[model samples]
Structure formats: C-alpha cells, structure tokens
Target: MSPKLDRIGSVHLTMRQVARATQNFSPSMKLGEGGFGTVYKAQLQDGQMVAIKRASKENFDSLRSEFRSEIELLAKIEHRNLVKLLGYVDKGNERLIITEYVPNGTLREHLDGIHGNYLDFSQRLEISIDIAHGLTYLHSYAGNARFCSAFGKCSNGEAMDLVDPQMREDVDEKIFKKMLNLSFQCAAPTRADRPEMQAVGEQLWAIRMKYLQLGREE
Candidate 1:
C-alpha cells in the first residue's frame, strides 16, 4: 500500500465481512451496475449503511490498477458533494471499494430518469451550483484534474436542451445563460484558456443567487 493509502482513515474490510454484509452479493442488495462492476447496498454490524463496488473478473489486472488509483485519488480529496470512501476489500482476485451510501440516488437519475419531475427549478439550479463547486475544488486542489466538457454545447438552444425538461419552463433564462457561459469558459479548448475553478465556482454561485432572487420575486 502507498503511504497515501495508508494515511487514509478508511477501514479495511475482509472479503468475508463484505460478503456477509452484502449477503454474498444478493441481487436484491444491488444498488447499481456499471462498466466497473456492481454496487451493493450493505449494512455493517455497527448498523452503518454503505455502498460496496465489486470489480468484475474479466480484466483483473486493469481493474485492480483502477481500484488502486481510485483509492489513492479519493483519499487525497474531501468534498461534501463527492462520495466518501469508507474502505476496500482486496482478497485474491476480488477487489471491492466501500463508500458512504447516498440515499437520494444519482444526479443523472434525478435529471433524466424516473425522478425527472421531482426537483423544482430552484432545486435544479442549486444542484448545478453544487456541481460547479465540486468541479472547482477538483480543479483547484486535485493535481490530476482534467477539463472534460461532457455537459454539452454552450449555445442557448443547445444548453437548454441539456436541462431537464421539467425544469425548462420554470428556469430563469438569464441565469441559465450565465451558467452556460461559465461552463463554456471552464471547457475552453486549452488548459491555459480555461477559467480557474475558483472563478467558475463564484460565477455559478452568482447565477444561483440570481435564480433564488427571481424565485422570491415570482
């Protein structure tokens, strides 16, 4: 284990303990499954709920490396919006990462899935601001941060298209546009061209405040 990993306050769980907590990876306990592996909702003996990610065996070496990288990266960073790594289990070919359970589900699910209409316009704007803050922290403090414009185009229509349909009608166009502009600036073609994360966070906060003010007026 690297010194960084050792320094992390996370507890290391044995494979048997993880299996028992997850009921031997029961399908009913599964929270989600992705390219990395399946995540299960587990309850520890101490009554703490956690999410455990178990790596698939297909690409053992590659997955192991990714697991180690994730541990190292997560250990160095701490943010309210980011998931907290609780621990990991590495026994033979099995690799599992344990993290704090997020009860409300993922942002993607809220924006595009069955929970689409659940969040109000103000809530959505606040979420956007929170994401920007998280990104800012990563860019400003995390050495491995990279700019990835995965959100979409910054054009008025294109940006609006990316917003959850339920939020579109109630969203403040002016604030939305400003948020898009900040996103565009952060995603500038070159690293040097991109605005610093602190600037992005400030801009996003300002947009959020404008949104809140508009809500009060209406």
Candidate 2:
C-alpha cells in the first residue's frame, strides 16, 4: 500500500480532472503509455519540458511498487543517457512521476529507422555501453538500507519498448561483440557468474579506451 500523502488537503480527482489539470496536454505531448500508465509531455513552471508518467489507480499495488522503485532508484544516480526522474505525486489515488524529457527519442529509433541520421556504430556502442554502465551503477550503487532488496533487473533482451529486432541485426561486428559479451555477463545462469555493475562499467571503459587508441593509430 502507498503511504498516504499527508499534504494536498485530500484532493480527490477523477482521472479526467487529473488529466486536464496537468501542466500541459496534446496529441504531440503524448509520449507513450505502458501497462502501468500513460506518459505525457508537460512543461514545468520554469519552461522545462518533462515527461510525466501518470500511473493508473487500478493494479494499485503494482503501480505503487513501480512508483516506489523509480523514486528510490533515480534519486541516487545521474547520467547522460539514463532517464531522469524529476518528481512524484501521490495523493488519493493520483500517482505520477515527473521525468526529464528525452527529445533524441529511444535508442531503439536510432537502431532501426529510415532517418538518414541513425546512431553510427560508435554511437550505438556508446549508447549500449552507457546503458550497461547505468545498470551497473544501479545494481551496486548502494542507497538507503530502508529500500534494500535492490531488485532491479536488466530487461534488454525482452521485446525492446523503443525499437525493433531487425534493426539490431545491422549493428557493426565490434559493437555486436561487446554487447553480446555484456549481456552474457549480466544474464549468467549462476548468480555468481554475473559481474557487478561497477566491474562491468570498468571493463567497458577499458575496452572503449583501447578501441579509441586503435582508431588513432590507423
């Protein structure tokens, strides 16, 4: 159960009312909705556009859990590629998490699209590396013990939310090699086989540095 918000003076809002009261709304503002909730593009008072995720009241426990997880996790870490969690609201069944808007779109789009401007091999490698590094930090980056059980898992292989599988095929050989290795390390059948996120980040960094040197020489 979500802990009640002591403030807000018990503002009871229907789904429709809540939608209208949001910072902004339009067809273009719509990012995407998942099983949990719909995401909207809202411009803050400071004129910063943010993606606000509005969680549905149904599946109360699941939504509450996700809200709690996102808040707790995003609070500690900060990175370029990693999505930023701006803030959250929980008052009388109205739960929402405000996050930074990523205009570049998902890595998936760059991976598969007619847009002449796609993430080059290096960019693709960097994005994947960045994601791996972020996950690594999340897994081992200790936070308040109150939120123990650090149960975040990498959902990479599963159907990607942002891109298609066909695009993944055209990735350069070297990029594929590194990604395969990282995925394998993360999903090692034996828990012991999985390397810590910190270790993985260090390894990826080392590999990237070496690759850069090779390019410089050639």
Candidate 3:
C-alpha cells in the first residue's frame, strides 16, 4: 500500500485495470515465476514501467496472509538498490504487489553473462559494496534481523576455487582474499561471532578505497 491508501498507502487497483495492462495475464508478459507466484512486466497507461508480483492461486488463504506483511514491509523500504513499491490489487482473491521496474537483470545474470557483459573485478567489487550498503540499510531500518545470522553458509572453498572464473583477468588476489575473509567472518556459525552489518559496510568501503588506490598507482 502507498501509506496513503489505508495506513498501507498503496493504491487500490481494480482487477480489470491490471488485466488490461497485462493482456489478461498473458504468458508473454511473464518475467519469472517463484515460490510465491509469477512476476509480470508491464507498461501502465500512464507510460510507467512496473513489475507486478501476483500471488499463487494454489494456496490463496495462506499466501494472502503471508504476503500481507511483505507488502507492508516492502512499502517502507526507500533505498535505491531496493525496488520501490507502487500500488497493489486486493480485489477478490487476486493479490498483487506492483513495484517500479529495474531494467537490469539480476546480479546472478550478470555474473553468468546471461544479460550483460561479464563483470570485471572492479565491477564485481563495486557491486559487492553496493550489496553491503543495501544490507546495512535493511538492517538499520528493519531493526529485527533474525536471518542476518544465516549468512554463515558461505564459503571460500579452496584458495582459487572461490574466485569467479569470469574475473580471472583482472582479479586482485589480496583484495579478493580480504573480501572472502570478511564474508567468512559474517557467516560464522555463532551469532555472537558475526560482525554487525554496519561494520561490514565500513570494511567493504575501506576495501573498495584500497582497490581504487591500487588502480591509481597502476
């Protein structure tokens, strides 16, 4: 909700309007399907591009209960890296969360060379910092981070095995090693052993500055 809509502020959209924009939920408009439901990309009549996340039909009641909070919490997020909530449709059992569309494919896609050119080491490093910043903001705003401790599953594997194959040409072993160490520290098995997100963001920035300094020296 928009916050202005009902305390949720999300605009109440009619199923007819959504159907019209989505070509009656045509398969062609589908961007992806996930555990919740399908996501569709559409251009609204006002020329606004948006991603619509429709709830799964199979588990209507439970899914509705689940996504209700998702809609509310997501609407509170205003960071650039995070998607912006626009409006929603709650008519009948048709539940949808509409958000501003980001044209760039997922980070995984760029890593795999699926949507963009392969990411160089510098690009990958900057992207990692961006992720850390996003996490910092999320942790600060949400306040309750029960899942932050779950990041311990990541691994450095063997020394060379952890590096992205695409970044072999420009990867800096020292900087990469520091990043891997920080990641491992974050994923420490015990919650008490993990660094705070704010601290993580700081270390990422410091590493990024060193990377740039080395670039200047080179």
Candidate 4:
C-alpha cells in the first residue's frame, strides 16, 4: 500500500517511542525544524550519513496528508538535482524518512545570502534544466498534482517569487504561450483543470530545454 494509506491506517504513538526507534540520531545531530517536523543529521551504525526527517504531530489532517504525499512521491523518483530518499521508518503516528544530506544547505539559503557566488544567467539556466528534469520525473511518474508540487519548491521558487512577486515579469513569446497553457490546464478554481503528470512533465521539459540550450550559447 502507499505510504499515505499506511500512515492513515497507523495507530498513534508517543514521542519517546518515536525517538527511540529512529535510527542514526544522536543528541547533537539536529538540523532544523519546520511545520513538517524536526530534521536531524544522522550517521548509521555503518557510518553512512543521512538527513532524518521526523514528522511533527498535528491536529490537522491536511498537513499529515501532505507529509505522506511527499514521502510517497519522493520514494518513486530519482534525479541528480532531486534529494534522494534513502529509507524510512514508519510505525503508527511516529514516522521518519531518511534522505541524502545536502550539506550545501537549502537553495533558499544560498540564494538569499550576500555572497558573490550567486548563480549567473548561464548557471541559472543549467540549474533550471536540472530542476525541470526532476519535476518532470515527479509529474510523469510520481503522480503529483502538477503545479501544486512544482512551484516554490526550492530556493529557486523563493528567488523567482522575490524577483517577480506578482509573477508579472515578462517572459519570451514561446514561454509566455506555454505558461498560459499551463495556467489553463493546471490552475483552476476546481481541481478538474489539473492535467496528468505525464503531460505536465513534457511541457516543463520542453521549456526547460529551450532555456538550457540558450545558455549553451553564452
């Protein structure tokens, strides 16, 4: 069964039980905490390092559903740009997902930093392609809700939003047309406008390749 269904069917457990059974976590191994849960830097008894994400306890079911969706979706896809899901420990209300530890930190952190090592146009193009490929895989194979899962998902999302807070910035003619179609197909008051993941991925791949090839010239 899918992780989402499994989580829903699970019986609730206390925090201590959750913590005790979680592998690789040490007292000093914390990374960060969010609405989702606390992330810790863990090293397996075999010396393999991983990022362990513990889901936060919440009264709301949507957040839990989102958590389950993320874990379920990520497990089925892999790409160079996407964070890898190594394994997971799921027992009732307490759940933990092991993932590759990206020490470079979140894209949001680096993008927002004052460092001169910012991504240039060419670099952005390449990174965009990478991100597009990752998203394409998710949409095509992971059965995500398309635009809901693609936008503002990483540092680029925040950067893009910050640069064009209103999303009114001008784009190329071809890109503009494609974006319009995406809006018509995926952005709707009703969920019916959402397209199949395969179609969404293809569209993203086409646009991303167009941008990436433009970078090759520079």
Query: 29, model 1: CA deviation in Å?
Result: 1.0
Regions of candidate 3 where Cα sits further than 4 Å from its true position: 1-12, 144-218
Give the per-residue Cα lDDT of candidate 4 at 182: 74
Worst 10 residues of 2 by lDDT: 145-154
Tens-place lDDT per residue, model 3, 98-135, is: 87788886677889999658999999999899889988
Q: What value of lDDT does candidate 2 attain over all alpha carbons?
A: 0.60
Q: Write the per-residue lDDT of candidate 2 for residues 1-218, one digit (tens) a residue.
A: 13333333223333454365453456677778777688887654455566767776675667665667556555556666566655566666767766668877655566786455866788878877888988776665533332233222113342232234667443334544565567667765457988999999988887788677766776
For model 4, the stretches where C-alpha displacement exceeds 4 angstroms are 1-28, 33-35, 59-73, 114-116, 144-218
Candidate 4's TM-score reads 0.47
Model 4 Cα displacement at 173 (Å)?
A: 47
- For all candidates in order, the CA lDDT equals 0.75, 0.60, 0.75, 0.61
Q: Residue-wise lDDT of candidate 4 within 112-203, one digit each (tens)? A: 66444776788778878888988777665654344545444422433233234466644455554566567557755446667877889888
Model 1 lDDT vs. the true structure? 0.75
Residue 30's lDDT within candidate 3 is: 88
lDDT of 3 at 150: 28
Query: How do the predictions measure up, each by TM-score?
Result: 0.57, 0.51, 0.57, 0.47
